[model samples]
Target: MASRVVRGGHALTEYLNAAKAAEPLYGDIQKHVLEAALRPSGRRQDVLHPSEMVKPDWCHLAAFHRLRLEVEPAEKRRTTFTRENIFQEGHETHTKWQRWLTEMGRLAGDWHCAVCDGYFWHDTTPAHCHECGAPSRCLTYAEVPLNAHPLRIGGTADGYSPQDAALIEIKTLGLGSLRYERPEYLERYTVPTDVGPVPDLTRLWRDFRRPLPSAVRQTQLYMYLASHFEDLPVDRTIFLYDFKSTQETKSFVVTYDESFSGPLIEAAAAIVDCVATDIAPRCNINSGSGCPSCLEFEEQK
Candidate 1:
């Protein structure tokens, strides 16, 4: 764990420029990421392993090392981007994200918070002051200190390092890009008439659900943790969108409280129950054309 010290102060703009120049090296990591992407929803252990990544789905295996996988149904696969192409295009935002962090390594001096316009002692992000709560960060550096922290992820002890993470988001637990609710045929068939038309929830989510269900669960868990054991100050996550690249990133916000216990596992059980009862076995995937929505409905013809 080495400290990133910038001379006199870090010239944020300069390092940012240099990182832009070094984009290709970052692009190479996308291949490894694509490996993770294709196999959505797995235990983090094998997914993050170096040997498992040897037979990369694409050449030379390069791209940011980590990403939330975006799985699409095999039937719906229409994108022509090679594994490399898609990952590279998709991973563009991640590259920028890492570069932003690497520049922090070059950070040098004390800076002011634009939001509260005051100084705080704690490192890392959320840039808030313990004294006065102000939601300010991603600060403009004036010889700032780039407090680099390791990304502690769940489902595995191993993940990208701080240096490598300066090139990636750190940890992500996600399945296919489009989260589906497997259709419920038995329930619809067994039940009688007007219990309200069992709606097609799929059509409702035609657009990308940019927000993660993980976040929702995180929110609920934080609520439970705060109520039961300690008062944890949960910060709402934010999205950073790039109009130029048409890329977007869900910014990382990590926090903890005085009661330095391990992550709350209790929240996971509730989430699993909800998924099993409400989401799993529910199907939303359907033909957008005027055709009948369900394969079952079409088959009974």
Candidate 2:
């Protein structure tokens, strides 16, 4: 037992020595990361994507600023590496699921012609581009562009399944969102219950769950645009939320409601109108309704 203790002590000392030797290296790497993150990303804010159409009041101002920036170049504010990393992770999650759906032959939607850049829904006969007569070999559905021309909103839907006649919108949610949405979730799941001392991670998802209001609005807008543009009669959306920690998923079938969606479109139209007139709307930053993009606009103004 004394020999064993001596060996353990030696191992601990080796680890401590190695960690001490690596301290400067780790510090250098962290400095580089922070510097890279702080560097202006130089990303263009040309169009206000559909996902960004959340705050109604800020929409017009944000859109107007984007248009103004097109004429006058400006440095865009850089987000923290943590927040940007989360976004990248969410994008990877969406890509993985979409790729899986494609591999499974479960994903459906219109085919985009690589040759002429035309879009046509999948049909019984051999698919071909209507505009340029490109064969099906030149068609793809990945990153399909969608536009609400009237509202001047554009974004790519995650996926679509003709079988269910529903559009898909995938979102990755971290524990922070759960804390905001259900503060009791962590406590209830991580604490010892009547069963045992170990945390019951399986019960993490409980009642009192609904899709984010912004997500619903975004999905509804997608459905409306898909139906109106493609004539696919898409009136429903499959809103899938993937938990980052557990890799578990919860889904909601969001049916499009004209009552809920109408005002959103109207709000988008107002933004477009504001942009057309080159008259910026009042800033909503003071009202606690602006996002990072809105804040950038406020700063630029």
Candidate 3:
């Protein structure tokens, strides 16, 4: 039996189109959402983010240009509304899952007690505890900030569970298909284009068994930082991929591998050196690709 998956956007468009006929406020609501999408939020940190480091060769030149922009501010390209909406959706998905875990008492986050010189579990830091009283100083977890300050690298991991000795990372992916659907043998599945079936360049649906390389790298870095910063047994990570359309999930267990992060940190060091010396590294990508860094570097001269 051949597994069948269908793009979810088309069906959603049809339903939305029909619903708009009855909903008078739909246009206004959409306008509000679009405005929210366009609004820029959060100050950009110049440090190397785990998410940004997964690109080819760390896309070091682009990163260098970005860090430079912080000091020499300039107008930079903005991502499209569609892309922004995708990010917003991913954030919402993470919140939804984490909240569910907390509600079910399965999500345990670690907190440090300065007085006892120990760690405990709770959603947030408490003002006082039995051992630690009078303005208890503590560090709480969940979206816990982890960093290698000397290396200029930092990021927040999704969640941590002391009980399982595992770190949690949530990912949201577009519904590339109805995962449960299967087609009879010899039945048509995908549109036959002149080139071929829609290019599954990432093999997203055709081979959905494994996590994306970028996601794995991001998680590996988080695990590495968690183990070092908190002394937690972050030898393993649980990656939960939630499909946006159906909210269906697929989970994978990734064990810590020094082989994955050693090169990442090494790359970060190279980029840091380039920035410190005020010398731009040679572009790892072709200038013909219109890399912003290449253009910015040329303009700086």
Give residue 123's error in model 2 in angstroms: 6.8
CA lDDT of each candidate?
Answer: 0.31, 0.65, 0.64
Query: What is the C-alpha lDDT profile of model 2 across 1-301, one tens digit per residue?
Result: 4221212343344334434545788644444444454444554455556676654444456567776566322343334435556777987888787766666666775667888887775532225677788886786666445676666667778887777888888887666666665556656767665886554556665542777666877777777778776566677888788877678888889887757657767766776788778786755544466656457656665
- Candidate whose lDDT is highest: 2
Off by over 4 Å in 1: 1-84, 101-234, 242-264, 267-301
Please give the RMSD of candidate 2 to the true structure: 10.9
In each prediction, how many residue pairs overlap at the backbone (N, C-alpha, C within less than 3 A)? 21, 0, 0
Candidate 2 wrongly placed segments (more than 4 Å): 1-44, 56-59, 71-81, 109-141, 180-200, 284-301
Q: Provide C-alpha RMSD values for all models, in order.
A: 19.6, 10.9, 10.6
In candidate 3, what are the lDDT values of residues 211-294, reduced to their tens digit?
666778888888887777656677888888886645668888988986788888887788888888989776676645546645
| TM-score (C-alpha, index-matched) for candidate 3 | 0.66
Spell out the clash pairs found in candidate 2: none
Q: Indicate the residue-level lDDT of 229 in model 3.
A: 60
